[model samples]
Target chain A: MNEKMSSRTLRTLPREKAFYFFTSIGNYTGESATSLKEFTDKISEVNVKSLEFHLYRGDFEKWTAETLEDQKLAREIENLRNQNYSGTALKEQLYNILSKYYEKIISKF
Target chain B: MKFKDNTVALDATDLRILNALQENARQTYTAIGKSLGIAHSTVYDRIKRMERHGIIKEYTAVIDAQKAGAKNIIAIMTIFTDPKESDKVAEKLCEAPQILEVYTSLSEELLIIAKVVAENQESLHEFIASSVAPLPGVLRIRTSMITKKFKETRFSIANNPKQLAFIKEKSNK
Candidate 1:
């Protein structure tokens, strides 16, 4: 079924010498290591693990609720805002939630 | 002119010229000078200095593929190969015109993300089969097509104050 869908989609695309922008993340070892370095530097400054930081300044809950359209996940993030979980622990919990959410959504695809 | 750090320095005027040219590279230096309230010769000299320093690489047109009778298919492909053979494989991949950009991921699993262009799906598939799949060390290949693009731009320089300061500082050094 997936093959059929892919074939149909491929056929529908227009003919052109398409320009592509490539980005590789995770386990990338190449000449363009600077790209990864810059990415990590930026991500490190974001403090992704701080639920309080996200609640006050970042859009973590709003993004989860609106963009991801996972109100339950957003609520869970909001709940974490008050919890005493350390930064690393909060990040782990968020990662697990996102992983599960992606698994459920991607299975539909 | 030599900056404090012996690097080429671009003053505010140079940056203004760059921003104008980035919007339309074909703009005459006289026009750019007029807009920025500088002499045309100064504009020309600044641009030449920037080019010499490798700041401005090339000026090229951005053509619409569909309008030009070509199909753009963006693909992210993971090429699994022995770690030792990865560089050789990447070098070979660069020889293919269809492949645009290649990057290796930093995961435990060696993965390659490739951007490819083709006239059609058949050619795209053929390129993968003949050029990529048969590579001696290739263990697996997984490709996902990009269906749409939301934003694309060539200009890395922004008119923001912080970015300008950074550029100035770097150039001065």
Candidate 2:
């Protein structure tokens, strides 16, 4: 057991290349390990156990920069960008955004 | 992001509580109330209801496995056994002290992810070779040690438009 524990200690956390590739800002064309280190440092203060970077669900094709740049939507996105935006903020922002989309549908009815 | 059918419904206040607790589980009710701008009594009541309904499962600190100095060996052990042998194998695996979490995957593979914090690697390896493999129905064990924790949390991004869109765009080939 002692021998095994020591060996395990030498090992570090595994990096899922695919996971980082998708979540990275802009087109991240660089060494994965290095890029990951940089990304990790940027959000190092944020304490989260395991971040499930959703690699699927809301497609960007649904809305363009112009749509997001609308005064209301822009403020919403800015609020979301706050460094202190935690899980609660994220959810609220999402609810508000979805509600706006819903409003667009309701008005057509 | 759309949740599954059984998604739990939570009001704004409830979500705020969950968010606070997720960041710091040991936070007191009074502290949580102060942060969320709710009364202490309400916080207490909501927590009680959440626990009863199974939303707040348990409070635990996120310990650094490396700092814990244990044999953190995460492995997917495939246990091939008949119906009669299933119970026997599962029983044995569960009994292992080093095994932290275990789950049976849909692929019929017994995914035994373990975080063994031992004094040294030799002891960990010995335990795996001598103790883990000898068990009945244990066919193969593939081990992978976590090299670096880029991001880890029990929280979910079921909502977050930016993150949701980010994921959606990536997945679409």
Candidate 3:
């Protein structure tokens, strides 16, 4: 369990795989989160519009699963996405999920 | 009328929390609750509730634009559009990234007040002539370039003490 959570869930990825934040198609927020912890921190600071944009498009699950290689976190994100939480509600829930996962990992160390 | 259904009626605690956040978003939960005589856990719970309700959005960091080399020339434009197409025009303007904010005028004429930012005068002119003036409903556009900014703020939560709901903190705060 610790091995599953430690590697990609918290390990910093290369610049190529960083989750680049965007408010719209061409509008980048200058944030490229390399790890789950960084992504969680960015989620709280990046505009909620960007959060809503990514949530509606299911981009969060895609990145967390494919890039981070953490299906557990990805599935949780997918479930949250399916619930149709929009705007700030979506942001609040996503932050809670990521923070909980982060704390769980930190406790082991 | 529209607010009747989904209004998040803020209680005294919620109001105090919002006021604290407005002052300094970087403050810890303990710092926020210190002035209001509430626990940090209570502060956390209240803030999360506000977020869930979509009332409290993301916390922002203020930047010194000039120091960061992100100095933008501010322009406030008043656009008069065809009455029938006013709403559509406003919506279209919102999709334009150059436009910072879009507000519909309540006066007699179908007017749109939009705050625009550009690198310089040429870009501003290009934006107005090419992107704005050529829009479907745009009849005419009047642009005023802001030379200096005196004050800009989103809210003054402390100013309103008349609300009976906030009577609890009238003494110290």
Q: Summarize candidate 1's per-residue lDDT along A1-109 as a digit string, tens digits.
A: 2544323222322111111111211111211101212222332333443333445432456544543344666687677665655566656665565555445544555
Give the poorly placed runs of model 3, Cα more than 4 Å off: A1-109, B1-3, B159-168, B171-173
Interface C-alpha root-mean-square deviation of candidate 1: 12.0
Interface root mean square deviation per prediction: 12.0, 16.6, 14.8
Please list the residue runs of candidate 1 whose C-alpha ends up more than 4 Å from where it truly belongs after superposition.
A1-109, B1-11, B159-161, B164-173
RMSDs, each prediction? 18.3, 28.5, 23.7
Task: Residues B132-166, candidate 2: write the lDDT tens digits.
Answer: 55554554455544456587556544356665455
- On lDDT, the candidate that comes out on top is 3
Per-prediction DockQ scores? 0.02, 0.01, 0.01
- Give per-model TM-scores: 0.52, 0.44, 0.57
Which of the two, 2 or 3, has more lDDT?
3
Error of 1 at A25 (Å): 22
Cα error of candidate 1 at position B80, Å: 2.9
For candidate 3, the per-residue lDDT at B5 reads 83
Local distance difference test, candidate 2: 0.47
